[model samples]
Target chain A: ELKVEQNPLFLSMQEGKNYTIYCNYSTTSDRLYWYRQDPGKSLESLFVLLSNGAVKQEGRLMASLDTKARLSTLHITAAVHDLSATYFCAVVYAGNMLTFGGGTRLMVKP
Target chain B: NAGVTQTPKFRILKIGQSMTLQCTQDMNHNYMYWYRQDPGMGLKLIYYSVGAGITDKGEVPNGYNVSRSTTEDFPLRLELAAPSQTSVYFCASSPQGLTETQYFGPGTRLLVL
Candidate 1:
């Protein structure tokens, strides 16, 4: 069974702070994806990491993948209240299906 | 394009009732999937189709059935609803490769009585 785990399931940070959300999978996979979901809303695609050491950035957020370690991280820089949301990482297998992590809920306070 | 669209944003069903959750994507994606999300658990794949006329089971497939009769539509069927089946259902579509990004719908919230 393929399992994806995210660390610091609940995060509370203040504005201008920096934090990283970690996602580790139990299997080897070359594809990883990050998504954000606000309360009662659909998921919004954040980043897609296709290879080892692949890094993608969007606004104040950056995501990196380490395929060798089967790990992915979403780094938040100078976070703001508007950036508060639940972030998820998914591991993709050869079958072209995604197994999602439990998700990290970030609460950024002013 | 509407990306991925799911109908009946919300619904309440009585036990043993049957209903279908409709999903369609205009991106011409060849892969469609259905997932269920609980309160704190991650999304679990229920069913998926590689293309039209090809459907397969996923991690959690019991009590659920899916059919992909066309490239753009994939509908999930709940034969007999139950309390445990009440969750947010999301339909997603992606292109045919493993590197493709899956586009998700707004999701359907179902509550079983």
Candidate 2:
């Protein structure tokens, strides 16, 4: 069974601050995905890190994957109130099946 | 393109009652998936389908069933509703491969009493 763990399950940060959410997996997988879900909404894809050393960024969020270490990180740079949401990291295994982390709920205070 | 769509934005069901959650995709995706999100938890995959007439179970697939009769429609059926099944259900679709991004529906909030 593939297990994924995320740190700081609940984070309250002031606007303009920076933080990083770590996602650690138990198995070896090359594909990791980052997704964001607002309250009462479905998930929105943030980034897809396909290989080791793969990094992708959009706006204030950036995600990186290190396959050898079975880890992925989602970094928030200069956070804003609009960026407040629940973020999740999922590791793909068993032929397209995904195992997701518990998730990080971020609350940005203005 | 409307992307992925699910019916019944919200529903309340008593124990032992059954219901079917409808999902459709307009992008002609080959892969569709059903996931459930509980309070303060990540989404867990219940089932998935790679294409029409092909269905498979995922991480959590005990109380639910799914069918993909057509390329654009994948509906999830709950046999006997229970309080444990109360959660928000999301349907998602991907074009072809694992590397492709999955587009998610708005989600259906189901409350089983």
Candidate 3:
């Protein structure tokens, strides 16, 4: 079975702090995706990393993937209260099915 | 355009009742999926379709049934609603396969009493 694990399941950071959320998978897969979900809301796609060392950034959020290590990370820089939400990292196997991590809940206080 | 649409944004069902959650996409995506979101667990795939007439089970398919008779529609059926089945259901679609970025619906919130 393909399993995805995420560390620091709960994070509480003050505004303007920097943090990194780690995701590790047990299998080999090249495709990884990051999504953000606010309380009571559906998921919003954050980034899609397609290759080893592939990195994508938007605003204060950036995501990177290392397929050989079967790991991915979502880095939040200079966070704000609006950035508080649950983040999920998912890996897509060769069959193209996604297995998601447990998710990391982030809270940024002002 | 409506990227992906799900019906009955919110519903409350009594135990043993049945209901179908409707999903449709206008992006002409060939791959569609049904996922259930619990409290802290991310999305758990219940069923997926590669294209019209092809359907497959996902990680959590025991309590759900799905049909994709057309390219634009994939509806999930719940035979007997239970408290364990109460969660937010999301419908997602990608252009080709699992490697593609999935566009999601607003989601349908269902609660079993």
Best by TM-score: 2
lDDT tens digits, residue span B1-113, model 2: 88999999999999999999999999989999999999898889999999999999999999999999999999999998999999999999999857989899999999998
DockQ of all candidate complexes: 0.71, 0.82, 0.74
Chain B TM-score (each prediction, in order): 0.98, 0.98, 0.97
The list of candidate 3 runs beyond 4 A from truth reads none
Q: Summarize candidate 3's per-residue lDDT along A1-110 as a digit string, tens digits.
A: 89999988999999999999999999889989999999888888899888999999999999999999999999999999999999999989747578989999999999
Task: Single out the weakest 10-residue window by summed lDDT for candidate 1 chain B.
Answer: B93-102
Against the reference, the lDDT scores of all candidates come to 0.92, 0.93, 0.92
Predicted candidate 1 versus true structure: per-residue lDDT over B46-72, tens digit per residue: 999999999989889999999998999
Residue B78 of model 3 has an lDDT of 97
Clashing pairs in 2: none
Model 2: per-residue Cα lDDT over A1-110, one tens digit each: 89999998999999999999999999989999999999878899999888899999999999999999988999999999999999999999988698889999999999
Q: What overall lDDT, based on C-alpha atoms, would model 2 receive against the true structure?
A: 0.93
TM-score, candidate 3, is: 0.96
lDDT of 1: 0.92
Model 1 residue pairs with clashes: none
Instruction: Give lDDT tens digits, candidate 1, residues A1-110.
Output: 89999999999999999999999999999899999999988888888899999999999999999999999999999999999999999998756678999999999999
Evaluated on CA atoms against the true complex, candidate 1 attains a DockQ of: 0.71
> How much is the lDDT of residue B75 in candidate 2?
98
Model 2 residue B24 CA deviation in Å: 0.4
